[model samples]
Target: MSEQLMVVGEITAPHGVKGWVRVRPETDLDQLAGIKRCRLFWPDNKERLFEVEQVRPHRQIWLLKLKDVSSRDEAEALRGALWMIRRDEAPPLPEGHYYVPDLVGLEVVTVQGESVGEVSEVLFGPANDVFVVRRSGLPDTLIPAVREVVKEIALNQGKIIIDPLPGLLD
Candidate 1:
């Protein structure tokens, strides 16, 4: 199998009889624009690398066309397959901004240097991304993505330091 890459989107369904497909992008629209090619993988581990032929925003979803796919049957066959691009292929973001997948598995600590937990997930809510910390022998805690609470995020070192407000972790 090819090395697993970051999933940028998924083939939700065939859009038309001429082979257009509706893609539900997991990445931001700006980030998606930077992906000129993608590696698609099916559930059975089958994979194909395709150059992006066209991409356009359609309502909330993205309409995509692959260089080789030319029929509704071809597109339908790819439904549910994850469309991934190399992590390095993603466009660079400004400082302090991070992709959700990049934040997972980082060690979380308090400003006092006490180990709080490890980041298990990054949840997208109406407000902002919530960092889900899984602590040992305790319930998971949700840390809001705010500058006041999150003092530092060291992605290179796989660490995060937070100064959680009182009762925030209770």
Candidate 2:
């Protein structure tokens, strides 16, 4: 039950001048659409709660219509707004998947029990996510989050067991 809020989507631009905005969602479109209310984080560091009026997929992106935004100007004003939700309210993830917050500071080690470093960040790349591991006196390591490299994710132990592919940790 973390009180932290996580961003799920962002308003990219106004869609058709009908007060509908194009949204780039981070999670499943269905899950994002199911959310009745959300916290909108504005570009100027302002936050407000908004009710979802409508949501529909348009090509690859989604078009979202929020309550009280019935004009093109109103929708345009929310150009860089992020759609946030409570951590506990996030949609359930599939098995073996972990949220970014949970993986961020966990210990990283090899399958043979060799200490590597701690996960400082996760970069979502085009192919897969890369775990940025920071060590004591060594340069940061970039470990690709693949099944072959990420052997085990022991969240209960607060560590990630990896089987690095030869030059991966270098």
Candidate 3:
């Protein structure tokens, strides 16, 4: 099967005197515990495969040691590099749960059958996610990622029907 790379974390900064790096995980802390290997992709499109040498929790960050990186300087050089892994490497999700990418490109329609827009992006928020919708004649709208407003989401059909609350379009 073709490799499906999914970004799992970002190199936030270099760690101590050693080459260990501080990573900001994109997945939940619990989900991160199972990551044993990852592929690093540089901003220039170069890719380096890495095996997780060590992983430990450090407050809000994850201290990581890659198989090849052994010094602080080497880790620092990787700062800002996105850490990716094959999609199949990830564990299965529970029912009714969907990844952010699955929401992209889904058609957004009102309960009345009017086309309001399409899902342009999914924004992460402190409390909940927000769906950014781009309409043809109106400015982009932010819809709270709630089941009430997002009446129904059909990933297979690539569509989402919403019963937007009052003034949601304004």
Candidate 4:
């Protein structure tokens, strides 16, 4: 696993006057449920750990109450803040499953070992995820995150093998 801290959610806005903040989760609900404490990363790169007092599902986001934030103003101050957890503390993935963060920056290669590019982004949709591979001066390539297209992901080697469909690179 990488040594960098992983962002799991973001404090979107203040909820009620009781220091609760609306969080847009980046991970699945099951992963969100396992988070009891996390570090709040500010824009200045400063981070502080906070204990989670309460967590409940909102419409499409989550409402979280941190232990120290006591007022609406306090929650408002936390706007745009990011919630992060240590890579080691993140929930373990099931067999054959990988975290999206782990895929970013991995070198994408063809089945025959042709260099494509590096993964710049992962777009999650209702059906599946898509990886945006970027190379200098070339348009980004979108690869579907499926078994047929994504042949193998060797995180330890920092490489991904993909079988591009017809016209996928165009």
Residue-wise C-alpha lDDT for candidate 3, range 19-123, written one tens digit per residue: 899988665445555667888888899888899888787876788899889888899989999988887776666776666656778999888999888998877
Candidate 4, residues 80-110: lDDT per residue as tens digits? 9898888877778777777778889999998
lDDT of 1 by residue, 8-127 (tens): 778999998878899887755665666689899889999999998888888778899998899999999889999888887877887877776788899999999999899998765656
Q: Say which prediction, candidate 1 or candidate 3, comes out ahead on TM-score.
A: 1
Candidate 1 lDDT at 51 equals: 95
Taken over the whole model, the C-alpha lDDT of each candidate is: 0.86, 0.85, 0.82, 0.86
**What overall lDDT, based on C-alpha atoms, would model 2 receive against the true structure?**
0.85
**Candidate 4 weakest lDDT stretch, 10 residues:** 26-35
Q: Cα lDDT of model 1 overall? A: 0.86
Off by over 4 Å in 3: 24-33, 53-65
Stretches of model 4 off by over 4 angstroms after superposition? 1-3, 54-60
Q: Ranking by TM-score, best first? A: 4, 1, 3, 2
Flag regions of model 1 displaced more than 4 Å. Answer: 1-4, 56-61
- Of candidates 4 and 3, the better by lDDT: 4
Candidate 2 wrongly placed segments (more than 4 Å): 23-33, 53-63
